[model samples]
Target: MDQFEVMSELYSDRSNWVDVRRYPSTVTCRRMLRLADFAAADPARWGSCRMAFEVPELSYRELAVARGVSHTTIMRHLAKAEVGDAGDFTARELDGECPEWLRAVSIRFEAGCTSRTYRYAVALCTFAAAQPERWRVLRLAYECPELSQEELAEVAGVSQPTVCRYLQPVRLEVDESFNDLEVIY
Candidate 1:
């Protein structure tokens, strides 16, 4: 189908739009609606922004099925939405802009850290900052504890490794005793 026809069908159902409970309040919903509307005003961005922001629970494949488009098209739209005005930033630029914790990890990784796990941690932070939508998906996964990391990765359009890395810090934080354990023989 043509872009116009696809977008028309997608937006025809108001119930298929964003879930307000996922938002902080009605005000946020209104703000998001305005943004979505603005995004939809441009025919080129309509489908992508809609899929990225409105029905976030659906995977790219699912979105493609719903929209009668290819999965690659869904991915392209979501990617564009994620980039938005921020665009892509280099690791150095991300390090400069990110929080101190992220910066520290990036610095250590850049210094040729021997630990592979540490490098993954750095990659996690860098990826999150670089793709805010993916970060949002990761945060949503925390809320939906029933979903496995694999499921979350599918929803987020990221790799399983990326989902695990995104969640590693939280897992570490909850197991403080692991850090204090000592063995004596």
Candidate 2:
């Protein structure tokens, strides 16, 4: 289960609330806890939102009254908290159009071999940096070997064709490697 589910289960009982500090230091838990404590919004309200509906003690109306808005506004805030913020994860800087190390590797590899593996590598790296969604699909494929391409696409919120296209470089590299080997038999 994800860290949020674990947090929900932990907070299901009032007795365990005191032990929240001992929750696993996974990304979700760390981000929620940090946001609850340090967000520009009121800490108690953020705590309620972070805990979400999992902790039944804080009512939406109560929060709405505190904020001087309708309960729907409070509900929306809670929903936003549950969804988490996109900026929570650090954005990747372009650093450079192409990293120097990758460029050097591509040059050396191309010089050493007839295969276009290095060329594909450079292309794939550039493609991934330029298109993060494709990179996410590729990453999901690597992280979940048991998952099929369609499943990976589903998990990455992309289409199966897109996943296949993004993975073409890796497939090409593997096929080329096999073709390069001599037939001993």
Candidate 3:
């Protein structure tokens, strides 16, 4: 009845009745698209570099190998891509970094992020990771998607008048240089 045995039993059978959360890959992909759009909005990010070049984890060497370019060209491309602080590197943006606790939760969400350690922190992180449009939608929806306006207000911990506040547009703002990520919204 302890945790280990429960997990072990669950793992032993393909047909175990235990619940497995399903990810809407489309939603994730759409969110990524939206994030890309947001990143692109900064004119500084424009360059010959493709999306692959700005990816957080890819090193200059890896990029060079992938593009069949010299390391210098890779570095140059990364600079042109405006990915931020090419001299330093961090895997996740500060505003999108989930706590170690939530790392496991992201796995449950099937999102390859740290949600188990962060819980709702993960949700906020993902929201921050999204594009402006996606962020607007997610912020409002998380306040309370299923509730009446009054109820939604309570859920969002805001005044009822604020439920409709979601319609007001807000721009997405990532919190730090991509190189030294710390925490998500």
Candidate 4:
């Protein structure tokens, strides 16, 4: 859940305080103190729209990258925030469904590696999807006709079988590493 959603839920309850954008400057200090007191008493209301308190102008990418979190995570925050007619937030899904080429490798990885998840694989795919340039580097050997298995594995950050899956044209194969995720291809 985005932190804002958490805030909104908290603010749903009643809070008592003057909504003072109209208070007299002669007593601005008093109103400010009262406002502070009100906020302290109802942290949830303050949290729900914390962004509104500051410059309050964060683009989607800026918000995600600044926080070092996924864009999807940011969207969840915004969606839950439900800020003024703000758009929608849908999480991308990348789970299970191993490529046909890795079937064999999936088996091999099982023998000596720890368990991993399709979610993990999809996370990698999500990373790749989010950053296209990175994909070019990872998939470099696919265009090279003379590279050997070790060379492909080195570039792919995975085992030879994992590379072999990439080498195949029709379907991605798995050996045994479905659980380990140690192999990177």
CA shift at 79, candidate 2, in angstroms? 28
Per-residue lDDT tens digits of candidate 4, residues 97-135? Answer: 533233223111122332232222223333333433334
With candidate 3 superimposed using the best TM-score fit, by how many Å does residue 73's alpha carbon deviate from the native?
Answer: 29
* Model 4 lDDT at residue 34: 30
- Listed in order, each prediction's TM-score against the native is 0.24, 0.26, 0.24, 0.22
Off by over 4 Å in 1: 1-41, 81-185
* Whole-model lDDT values for every prediction: 0.43, 0.44, 0.38, 0.38
Tens-digit lDDT track of model 2 for 84-132: 3434431211345533243222111122232222223223433443455
| Residue lDDT tens for model 1, 1-185 | 22222222222212311354432333222333333333434433454544443455678788788877788877665553321223333354456864334422311111221222222222343344344554566566756989988898888788888887777643212212112222222
Total clashes for model 2: 0
Best-to-worst TM-score order = 2, 1, 3, 4
Instruction: Please report the TM-score between candidate 1 and the true structure.
Output: 0.24
Error of 2 at 91 (Å): 29
Could you give candidate 3's per-residue lDDT for residues 59-100 as a string of tens digits?
778767766778886565445222122232223423557333
User: Which candidate has the top score in lDDT?
Assistant: 2
Top model number, TM-score: 2
